[model samples]
Target: MAQDWQQLNEQVTALLKTAREQVLAKMQSPLTVDEKTNRKDLVTNVDKSNEQFLIEQIHQIDPAARVLGEEGFGDTLQDLDGRVWIVDPIDGTMNFVKQRDNFAMMIGIYQDGVGQLGYIYDVMQDVLYHGGPALGGVFAGERRLKAPANIALADGLIGASGPLVVHDISHMQAIVHASAGMRVYGSAGIELINIMLGKTLGYISYLKPWDIAAGKVLLEALGCQVTTIDGQPLNMLSSNLVLVATEKAQRDILQIEEDDVSL
Candidate 1:
């Protein structure tokens, strides 16, 4: 029998809300922090605990589904075969630890490598950006989001990873100069939300699958483009220079990069 995804969406939404609340309550106490790869890449006890809690709930809801999580608490998935859930329990661990805000919980549901549903929850603001192709449209809270205008890159703000801009990778400096301006919010989920809200024309970053998975589903549902910086399809299991933008913005940005290369 096929799964009732709408029913599952409702169930998982409630589960994520409960898990977020529990994590928030613990935030009032002290945090146990550790460095992942470097001092800039930090993780706290909350990150691990939240991933564990989410994975446990996912197991209860769909034991057959595979879960890929940031904290390494979920399954070791090599491919997106059957039912799979890609999750980031605390997306901006740095922001969560240092600023206590601007973080999110994200989940993307895929079956046979096809996206079915996506969710990005702004845990501090209690805003959820969710839905997917199967849902017919994406939503902010209960309000259905309209597809953003196809604004060109030069006319709208762009959300970018600060490091990418500072290091000038892939002519990122040139890209920033061509945009109306740039905003760095530190959380990929929040940055993607900015694009969904039409607050930013686009966002670019070197993102892992878990980082962009949920946002990719919702972005595509809203008629936005999610692809590599060179305008290639994103690999669901590998990191890439991901760009989520309106159609026109994507074309404009890629053209700008191309022009820079020619010069």
Candidate 2:
């Protein structure tokens, strides 16, 4: 069957907005939270409900499409063979539950393992960053985004995972010192947004499939590099220490000299 990618993009855009409304409505009341892995890793009624809502609506739009969602409301897929949708109903669940801000809802559509369209909605800010290769370029709402300047590492701010920076993993401290500074936003979507807007030159973090999926589509469309910390292709099925940055920043990062660097 022939797929109308533009039409699919339109449908997904509307779906993201509707999911945002549902999430905001659910947040108006008290939330029931639970620990997933540890004290710091949490999930809430809002996360589960939002994932269910998104998956259900997505099936209605493309009944043949397979969905992989964080909350276990979708399929247990082992491969990305066909039309596959990866969704993080709410990224930064910790920020969402505690701060009620700095969280985003992200969705990415792929066909035969190629990204087709992506959407990341900053619910509290009411800003949506969306688009893909098929859409020509990325956009912040109706405004088309230009490619961010290819700034070098030492000349621009970098986004980093808090744990990575604190623990000095992968010579993270050295990498940060090589840059102007580091900012930890706790949400990959927000970090990606800052990069796309040219507010930050790069971001490095440990990310799962859903965490990087949507942002990958958007950033790659904008000519940014999205790769593993070692500058390898992403598996999309495995968690990785990922790097998203402009070309020059990526080169600077990959070539940073690791030595006795202190914070």
TM-score attained by model 2: 0.96
The regions of model 2 sitting more than 4 angstroms off are 1-3, 257-263
- Top model by TM-score, which number? 1
For model 1, how does the per-residue alpha-carbon lDDT over 209-251 read when each residue is reduced to its tens digit? Answer: 8899999999999899999999999999989999899999899
In model 2, the clashing pairs are none
Q: How high is the lDDT of residue 110 in model 2?
A: 89
lDDT of 2 by residue, 1-263 (tens): 22487788888888888888888888989999999989988899988998999999999999999999988899988899999999999899989988999999999988889987889999899999999987888999999999999989999999999999889988799989989999999898889999999999989999989999999999999999999988899988879899999999898888763333455
Q: Per-model C-alpha lDDT, please?
A: 0.91, 0.90
Model 2: which ten-residue window has the lowest total lDDT?
Answer: 254-263
Q: How far out, in Å, is residue 22 in model 1?
A: 0.7
Score candidate 2 by lDDT: 0.90
